[model samples]
Target: MGAMSHPHHPGELAAPDPVRLLAVRDTPLSLDEVFAAVGDDAAGGTALFVGTVRDHDGGADVAGLGYSAHPSAEAELRRVAQKVVDDFPVRALAAVHRVGELAVGDLAVVVAVSCPHRAEAFAACRRLIDDLKSEVPIWKHQNFADGTEEWVGA
Candidate 1:
């Protein structure tokens, strides 16, 4: 899709593309989709981050995890993405967090940032995921192999 255009007053250029994509969905997340959203001719580098469910956490055997998001989660994601764009020299950006049950190795989140250089792209991508994890209202319910369950990042 083309970059969205916003209304601008006279003598003002159009606003730069802030975030190419931002979403919270119950279905599995896709790295390709996120990467494609940030594809820009002006960008010399693109950084991508994919977070997946691991088999273990804190030395405990994790069987799987179920992600749940508050009603404001999507909005919070957009807020976080926009912050990264504003703080960095980002040409384009995208972020998606997955909800619903997921097995081990399944993707939990995917984020991408494109910039004029590798350093900025990497920094912006890192900031996007870090802020999203810290600010977004998402919880993880982990199922352990030992027949126990725990809630994390609530």
Candidate 2:
């Protein structure tokens, strides 16, 4: 019971935060870097996710897209990562999101999580990406081949 309790609770120990990397960059994302950042000797499982720009979306032919992030985007991203570390037994975690113009098939984001088991790693990685997408102040401007444009999550 003592070990299971959180530090905020009376007589409990605080676990070290497991966020290893967090970034919102205008350059292309690197899967290797993200994966390496989450490497942990104690971790038996590692889960990784990469988001890529596709040529089509919602029946429209996407020509390209540009991502723009608010000044606080990186800080918000760290908050999301910290939440995942607190909720899961994350041994290590990393995430990087790309900004600026990206062509179809470009890597838009890369995230990885390592844990003592496969299930935990997968769950943490999923939650990290989901929360980042919804909570971060990153907007996407998509251009269609038909000369149409749309803003998403602005």
Residue 121, candidate 1: how far off, in angstroms?
A: 0.5
Question: Candidate 1 — which residues are off by over 4 angstroms?
Answer: 1-15
User: Judged by lDDT, which candidate is best?
Assistant: 2
- Local accuracy of candidate 2 as per-residue lDDT tens digits, 32-143: 8998998877788899999999999999999999999999999999999989988888888999999999999999999999888889889989999999999999999999
Question: lDDT (CA) for every model shown?
Answer: 0.87, 0.89
Measured against the true structure, the TM-scores of the candidates, in listed sequence, are 0.89, 0.89
User: What is the C-alpha lDDT profile of model 1 across 1-154, one tens digit per residue?
Assistant: 9976778432132128748788889898887788889888777788999999999988999999999999999999888888887888888888888999999999999999888778888998999999999999999999999989999987
| TM-score of candidate 2 to 2 decimals | 0.89
How many angstroms is residue 122 displaced in model 1 relative to the true structure, after the best TM-score fit?
0.5
**Candidate 1 displacement at residue 104 in angstroms:** 0.1
